[model samples]
Target: MDITQLVYFIKIVECDFNLTLAAEKVHITQSALSQVVSNFENGEGILLFTRKNGRLNELTPAGHVLYRYALEIVQKHQEMLKAIKNEANKLVGSVRIGIPPTLLRSYFIPFLPEFISHHKNIGIEIIEQSANELKALLLDNALDIAVLVQPAALNKNQFEEYSIRLGEYAAYMSIHHDLAELDKIDWSDLKGYPVGTFQKSLTSYHIVLKKLKHAFPKAKIQFTSTSWEYLLETTKDSNKIVIMPIMPKKSAKQNYFLQKKFKESLSFDIGLYRPLKSFYNPAEIILHGALIDFFNSGIMK
Candidate 1:
């Protein structure tokens, strides 16, 4: 039954079957409340209250069952209305977000505390995925938003994106490596050393690999890994160079692992992605605002 009928049903029981008292408690006329009870009993094909001299008396077995369920429905309906009212006043909901593992520490870690404090009602669900996987999730609507390295090319017809920041490919090497002393190194300079990088499943890995191979066809890439730790470890001890996105200084404290800027940098367009939409919920609007504020704070600089 609808909420109004459920409420009236509960009120009648609470008023001890007094039609006048129940109707007055519920701000309705006595005859109107009596007719509501009659219509409900007729609709369900069950006698509710026993009649004594044409007056409502004790409840029947069917009436007792309806009373129990009616109480529950009325209570839950009140809660639902309260929740909707709260949502109208403030952001209140959950948002599924996808982020690259590498960017979590650099980008989100610095700003999450303050953002979370400001929007306590908003629940955040974080998913870690590669850039390619994140893009797929956005397209499928499995994720509400994704913080990923922007694709080299985007189809505006399918997706909407905003660039929050930019990154670049850098060669990370051990301090003992001869090239570590250089101010800038070119792709040709990496020929003397083996390179370690992420696997082909990552869009960033694929983009940089294509450029590397185009410049130096004979260049040897000795290692490929999906784990960031494996690539970082390889570059921390030997002359092997790891080609990857430049990590924020706060994220990389290993002085032994030196970073050499690329002479001709392959820039990474990093930003937020969402399915193209004209409207967003209050929670999504707050999340977008947090991201913009974090990026513009110049903490990354």
Candidate 2:
């Protein structure tokens, strides 16, 4: 039987043939409770109660068996809740989350230490996937949270999004490239040159690439391996430029030796997301809070 039916059944047994009293206790109508209990009895192929008055009657032998099991089930459920609350108080759990490699550099590295510090008992597992992949993982319950650009490019109903970073995006060109000689290049320029890019399949990257492709229809494009390290390697020798959102001075830096100039000025949304059910759990709450605080305060000194 469903929890609703079980609850009403338990109350009816406790109230002992007083449908009004049981209904009052459960805050449901007597008819509703009676119909639910009757349905339960019909489905179980047994008489649940004896109808002496027009209300809840006495239990049959089968009814006694069902009541005992129901009470045990209810007590076990209460114990389960108490155990979960105790675990929450201890702050001991593992949170598995997904982050886009495309944006992880800008988002994760700086925030990781603080998250670990704030919730020492919460072990974190990160699955590096494209934003699109992360979305599916979240919907399927394989991931607890995802760091992505925004909810607009995704199925909004599947995710609860919160913007954590608001920053400008820049197109990066090799210093030796001709475009680098210009003070600034407009969207219409760079049509004939190769442009370094991240995975076009990614929602955020695809959104930006759409605009760039519109501006430079003839531009040759190359996708990076979705790491800052590889992005920097492209800058060292390749003439192609990669678009990036420069981190604030406080972000964790890998190597700051390379010079970055503003190529084309643009901006995009950045956010953290999880399934709505995730917020109800304590482990997710702590980890989510840690990530929120990590972004609110700078992660790297």
Candidate 3:
């Protein structure tokens, strides 16, 4: 009946009719959420869910009909509020952005101080996770935008992408390692060495693993980690080769390890991606533009 009830209804459906999960997502107690649903159904004189052994099974026919309208109503209501706030001031709302841990430390951290200084009124929440995890969050509407190491195949229709930088997967080794003497290393050169890279949650892990396996089926990938620093530090003193995207200029200069590009050019685009949505809030719009301008200006290069 009301917007809050409609939101709860939508959340319940999104949680696959699991009331407990829906309640947790909405930050309400299960009993309170059940009361809201009961009140709504009683007031409407209709059953929204089909019950199986006292558990929510699925949406009823009438529930399906209401769901479509509820989604539109809630979306429109949110858009109206965002529009009003945007008109009052273009940079007022909080924008949630997701970034992989590696990229955040090497690339985005440098840009944040400038962005925050310029738009002090706008709030920025950064969610650090793997590229794959960030993609899921972006699609779920939990993130306004994300910086992803763009997959070779992406659902272009589902997302709007802006290229931030192009980088290539490279071998990093300690200066004392034999491979460090080479300006460019071939995949075959890494054959017998102990390899280390990112965890399975990251796109870089899959891409590098595929290449390594194809080049040398017996490739010894000895370490996998979520932290780039950990991966670097773990291999820095050993003969182990860490495969990752080429480090940012500042980091490359400061780090003790040396980088060597692959002979085959294993490359990826670091991009800003957002779900293709009908409405974008003022903060999202401003941040998107600023990001594009910042990257294009060669400031982060």
Candidate 4:
């Protein structure tokens, strides 16, 4: 029988076989409740209760067994519904987000705590990859959302982008390096020094390397790494120069390195991106908003 039928059976058993009291408790007419139980008894071809003076007096042997199973079934069913409702009411789920190593370091790292605090129900899985790799993951449906650097002329059909900020690149070096003393520098000045860049898969690395090579074809390119730890170490070596985006610095670990303004800026746009026409879970939507708010708050300034 269905849950409602089981519930009515349980109510009648608990109400001392008094049809009027059970009907009132379950919000049904006594005659209707009696007919329902009568139909059930007839359908099963078993007497569920004994009758005296045209009133239900006591349960039969079959009635006791039915009552036990019906109570358990109805209670368990109710608990299941309550559990489902609670889950529906809360924003609870896992979200996979991709971000380039540079943005994760300069922009997203500092603001992560506040974002998590606001959405405790959302579990975050941060996938660190190059911007192009992030885009590829989005296309493969391997990532829920990503923060990427968009080229000036973006392909609108590629993905849906929510612009966050515009930024550019500059040279960073150890304070002891002679180039650090220059208020501003040009690409030609980079010819003699060892240049360290992010891996080729990174958008920043591609942008910086193209410009640096075009101007100084003979530049000493010494290192290429995906790890920020290694890149920062390269900068502190007092001889090597690292070219990276001109976003706000979050860690003082890079304090030993000085940033120089470029005579001609190498500009890029940064934003949150998602697969085109893809559906987002509740957690993903909240996180997307948090990323936009974090950018607008000038935390990346």
Q: Which candidate has the top score in lDDT?
A: 3
Candidate 3: regions farther than 4 A off: 1-91, 152-158
Candidate 4 lDDT tens digits, 1-301: 6789888888888899988999999999999999999999899899989999988888899999988888888789989999997886675788899989887876776788778876777899999987777877787889888888875233579667788987777788898997877899988888878888888777877788778878977554578888767886877857888888764654633557888878987778887887666567778788878788878887677
Report, for every candidate in turn, its global Cα lDDT versus the true structure: 0.81, 0.70, 0.84, 0.81
Pairs of colliding residues, candidate 3: none
Model 4: how far residue 47 lies from native, Å: 54
Score residue 247 of candidate 3 by CA lDDT.
72
Candidate 2 at 194: error in angstroms? 2.2
Instruction: Flag regions of model 1 displaced more than 4 Å.
Output: 1-91, 152-158
Please state the error at residue 42 of candidate 3 in Å.
Answer: 82
In model 1, pairs of residues that clash are: none
How far out, in Å, is residue 172 in model 2?
A: 2.7
Question: Comparing candidate 2 with candidate 3, which one achieves the higher TM-score?
Answer: 3
User: Where's the lowest-lDDT run of ten residues in candidate 4?
Assistant: 246-255
- Encode model 2's per-residue lDDT on 151-173: one tens digit a residue: 54656687688888775666665
Per-residue CA lDDT of model 3 for 17-107, tens digit only, reads: 9999999999999999999888878987999999999988999999999999999999999999999877665547899999887677767
For residues 14-118, write the lDDT of model 1, one tens digit per residue.
888899999999899999999998887888888999999999998899989988888888889889999988876564778888987767754787777777877
The TM-score that candidate 1 achieves is: 0.64
lDDT of 1 at 12: 83
